[model samples]
Target: MKKILRRLRRFIRRLLGIKPRMVWLTHPVFLQHEPGGSHPDSPERIRAVEAELKAQNIWRHLQTAEAGEVSDTQLALVHSRRYLHFLEANQPPEGKIYRIDDDTVMSHDSMTAARFAAGAVVAAVDMVMAKKAHNAFCAARPPGHHAKSGSAGGFCLINSTAVGAMYAIAEYRLQRIAVIDFDVHHGDGTTEIFKDDPRILFLNVFEADLFPFPDLEKERGSSPNMLHTPFERGASSLTFRRRIRNEWLPVLGSFKPELILFSAGFDAHRDDETGRLNLHEADFSWLTHKIVQTASSCNGRIVSVLEGGYTLTPLGKSAAAHIRVLAGKGRGVDVMRYNRRLKQRT
Candidate 1:
């Protein structure tokens, strides 16, 4: 019955020439990557998000695409050739796991999965640039914000967000692109990759004294293009929203970005044990809505890539809320269905 109703809605929209503006990108290799030994960056993370989106009946409403693998040459745009070659050369045996650092590891198929994760972002950029979609969410695994140009850290193998940003600049000649990261931990890798590039503006907010780089809290005022907002432990929802509105929104409006890429991390959810900050699903919806309104002024193009979300239930719920707003679903139930019911009653 649900499937039938969904198809009916699609058919009616087609008749009215109403096309969806949001695209959801995923790849099977995301599940194939094994980080090994109770690592928080698990395949189950993507599974949880998928299940929730479907459970909320949000999955069938948008266009879905399988992400293709990124090419080595394209990867070289942001990553070092030596690092790319090293990642290519170091693949563990089928049964073994290779540890890149204390926090990151690689299984036999990890490289393939990493390439496809980056590929999802690349595909999303192409879709939005071509105006095929207003925005996209890449739900692939092995998050990329932590991976630098030359090395991997904090479970990221390839810097997929950087790849997508560079791809947009190179392929579309876009200037003044914006990358906003609201993850629990600092996006040290993204900062390192884009700190020198004047074309890109990187805005990041993370928990102070958390994992990765605690010193980033002190260096917040150093870079002109890079803006950092570090929250102390147990920061509340009010603090989160207030800071974003005060700090991120003004800069975003003034920058008037050609494209906005979100490192959409949900680990800040209060229930998630990975991060100490406190945020809820409603906050995420509000954030996405604000981003959408900002995008409305500048061609309405956004590409959101998943970063860090550890605990299962909150991760799923938070991601659904974010995707819902991206799909223009708003904070309430589906508006189309509500309209149809009202018409029937009338």
Candidate 2:
């Protein structure tokens, strides 16, 4: 009787110990909506990262979610109704491209995929807030940071991260949200949407003189809260760390945000063709550690959304490192083996 009772307690404890990490994965069908020839924002990028994660055996640990389409009502929380209607009504014909701007384009499937991309972030916020998982990572494309409330630019159709932040505020009643965008390119659309809002803190670090030119400085929003750092081309990991230490860390520590969101972009990788920032895979690992460290004050709440990473090797490496840190698997600790060799290395 005593042994059975002990066994039962052990089983219950094991079940309770399961800490699932949530990750939203967009379908490869999202690739079918390509707008132009041989673009860097291809479906192959996500596929490659997925394959690498699977190879590392970390894929099984993630709670996978198929992102659905976000309704106009939900999108309207951030975007104007008129713009939403225009996007829904102007469905581009198959094999034909409809240009929203000089750089943004739409295809027959672009709208549908964009809706899913935005919806992924919204769903991730819900999952984290509901305690379904400790945190989440949205793996979607047609990246959101470039899309404004009224218009799309820089290959983006909908501002997914902004929409997600709005949903957290309006639906989840979450106060004091923080958005940290580390994409190589500036998140102009996200900045534009929340520039005036004080409840949200938008911190962006991007390469200076990059696309969507004219970077952000200490511009006071309506609520008067924003931070923008522009780094020169070929900036090293040390410089990256210094800027985060000097600029972002203090602000975040002061804010003590309830929820943290990361616009994770790997274009800063040295191998990426789109940007010239010289960040290696280890830099992403270090940054992830810092973000997680910041989130610890808020009980370790974080949601990271994939934005851009053009190259295969660096994107996969950086993403794996980021996920590893988020999962608490890369803290110089090995869980699979309790051997002397691994223990000594750590």
Q: Which stretches of candidate 2 lie over 4 Å from their true place?
A: 1-17, 215-223, 331-346
What is the lDDT for 84 in model 2? 77
Winning model by lDDT: 1
lDDT of 2 at 114: 87
Instruction: Quote each prediction's TM-score.
Output: 0.90, 0.88
Q: Give lDDT: candidate 1, residue 112.
A: 93
Error of 1 at 31 (Å): 0.2
Q: Among all windows of ten consecutive residues in candidate 2, which has the lowest summed lDDT?
A: 331-340
Q: What is the C-alpha lDDT of each candidate?
A: 0.86, 0.80
